[model samples]
Target: MSTGQATLPLLNTTLENCRMVIIGVDPHKDVLVAVAVDGNGRQLALRDAPARPRGYKTLLAWTAQFEQRLWAVEDVRHVAGGFVRCLLAAGESVVWVPTQMSSDYRKKVRASGKSDPIDALACARAALAEDLPAAVPDTEARNVKMLLDHREDLVGEMVRMCSRLRWHLHDIDPDFAATIPKHKLHRPKWNKSVQEFLARQAGSVAVAICVELIGRIQELAQRAAQLEREIAALVVIHVPQLLALEGCGPLSAARILAETGDVRRFTSAAAYAMHTGTAPIPASSGNTHRVRLNRGGNRRLNAAIHRIAITQKRMHEPARTYLDNRRAKGNSNTEAIRALKRHLARRVYALLKNGPDHAQADTTVQAA
Candidate 1:
């Protein structure tokens, strides 16, 4: 799952009043090994099923023996999309188990060995030991997230292809790089003469490479643009308020909403910031007391926040004043950026939670 780290707290508060059956699954490309356990942690059944619609149906029937069954899935969004989607559509209660937690549980159970069945059992035990949050896979958010990721990949391919063309042009004709505008070089409209010249270099490998890379880049660019339009349309409908923020564009708004399915799940702005990796971590000792930038949490969401902070620092008057004040107080550039990101995180949280009417920023800077 593309989520912030899911930690099993030390308190170990589990479902006590109601008895619930946990069906833990270790999914793979072709098969899924699953184990069902009682609320008290006793294994009920273990089964190996094919990873298909028919197998999913059979698995449901098998688990039906239990009156109330909750599916505990590992990395539901990424590694087990097919099954997770099917389960969510079927309206089954699902809980996500992080890979680290599952592995740690497995080591405690069987210190010397590892296998699908063992992992499945460990997942069930972990679920039984903690109050895991339920997973709600929203159809709209999932579609938008996939499109955003696909567009990013397409953009990366375009950059690689352009870099290859630039390097080849530099090596073949050093003067070509200086004369041709970098931005114009990737277009089909590049002077017809240059194309003819590259085509004439038949004996050289660079000629073939350049021609192939250009074709791929053009195709990728077209697809990326199409995905961007789709993502923007979805964001406008689902999260128009986010777009109203000073620096959040359609893509940025979509990413934040997609990563965080429901704003209500976070109890407060601090929780939201921590989930986004913008919250500072304590780095203090006997002689000094201070906070440092968190290096963990949702990296993609962190990147979106960084982009917004950079945009606001460029043009937003309030953001500039805040940065200037922080700098004047002796904060370094990196620390100032972190503080700004934290502010944006809290701002986004309030906006998402309070609706569009609360879109305006306070313009009151916080202490550095």
Candidate 2:
């Protein structure tokens, strides 16, 4: 779903007469409903398959036999790992049509309730008509996906446990915030210390509130530690370069890698910046021309870029100069950092696209 704002002209003109195929998949908890359509938007097949082994096998069989120039499937963001992996293994040209995009088409086409077959047909028609979106390729796709999802899960669990801990804390120590950090400690290393502190405090509270808080924090810490280990392992494999960058530790690098699946998909540095929301948006209608900050694109990527920029501002001559210039122009710290984020994204994109030589050239030219 991450894409640059620089919209390239559609390249499917050469595919006008080519046979395109679409396998519309509506994945559920236990079942996946799939329907196939031909190039001319003809319904070819419809079936309900098991969400696991049998369904995946069925989809793969169809993919192998079909002559498809484009195999459009619904969003692989939240689901469709097995399906996408199957398509990729078979070397099929897969396009990921966003769920919202497909839903909008259904609303416009049918304007009524939908069945699996009908929805699949709609998806196929969209693909044949070149209304489908390009599939986003991930750089360290598999590992990044696991790390990002697991990290988020751990964070959510920590949040839940912290809420309970706060309730318990409120009952025991009214002035707890004045003594301790406002946020609950999440690291596993701090788990025993926090538990012991809670245990000691609860002995004095007479309500046993600290006992529950200690247990919850310990559980949360263990989960967070597991997530950290998984993310570190993933970074060692997929995003080693990202980790090498200043301020882009394992966790941050993993987040960036997950957000930007494949930097090669972007045509240029500007395009990559635009997709990350670090590229500014030009507000020129007729004559009034100015580039305002863009608000769209992947927010997580934008955050990562900003963090990199902030890190670079220290000990880097050019980055420091840029930040000073922005500040002298009356821009706040946030605004200056955002501008730096844009520049940093472009640099990162160039590094990914043309390697160190071209990136150095770009930096030299910018400096001049």
Each candidate structure's TM-score, on Cα atoms with residue i matched to residue i, is 0.75, 0.68
- Score candidate 2 by TM-score against the native: 0.68
Tens digits of per-residue lDDT for model 2, 1-368: 33755333332513565465567776665777777766565667777777787778877776666665466676645567676666666666666555555666676554478876666666666556643335543445656767677767767877776666666656666576334455645555444545655655525653365556556667766776777887788777654655545556677777777776666555567757756788776666885544677765666778777777777777567777887888787766777777778777866665555433342243421431
Residue ranges of candidate 2 with Cα displaced over 4 Å: 1-18, 22-24, 33-48, 57-66, 98-141, 184-209, 222-230, 233-238, 244-246, 262-283, 290-299, 310-317, 323-342, 353-368
Best by TM-score: 1
Candidate 2 least-lDDT 10 residues:
359-368
Residue-level lDDT tens digits of model 1 in 149-231: 88898888787777778788788888865676776555666644457768767567877777776777778877888889989
Stretches of model 1 off by over 4 angstroms after superposition = 1-23, 35-47, 62-69, 76-79, 98-133, 178-205, 265-271, 292-295, 320-336, 356-368
**TM-score, structure 1 vs. true:** 0.75
Task: Output the number of the lDDT-best candidate.
Answer: 1
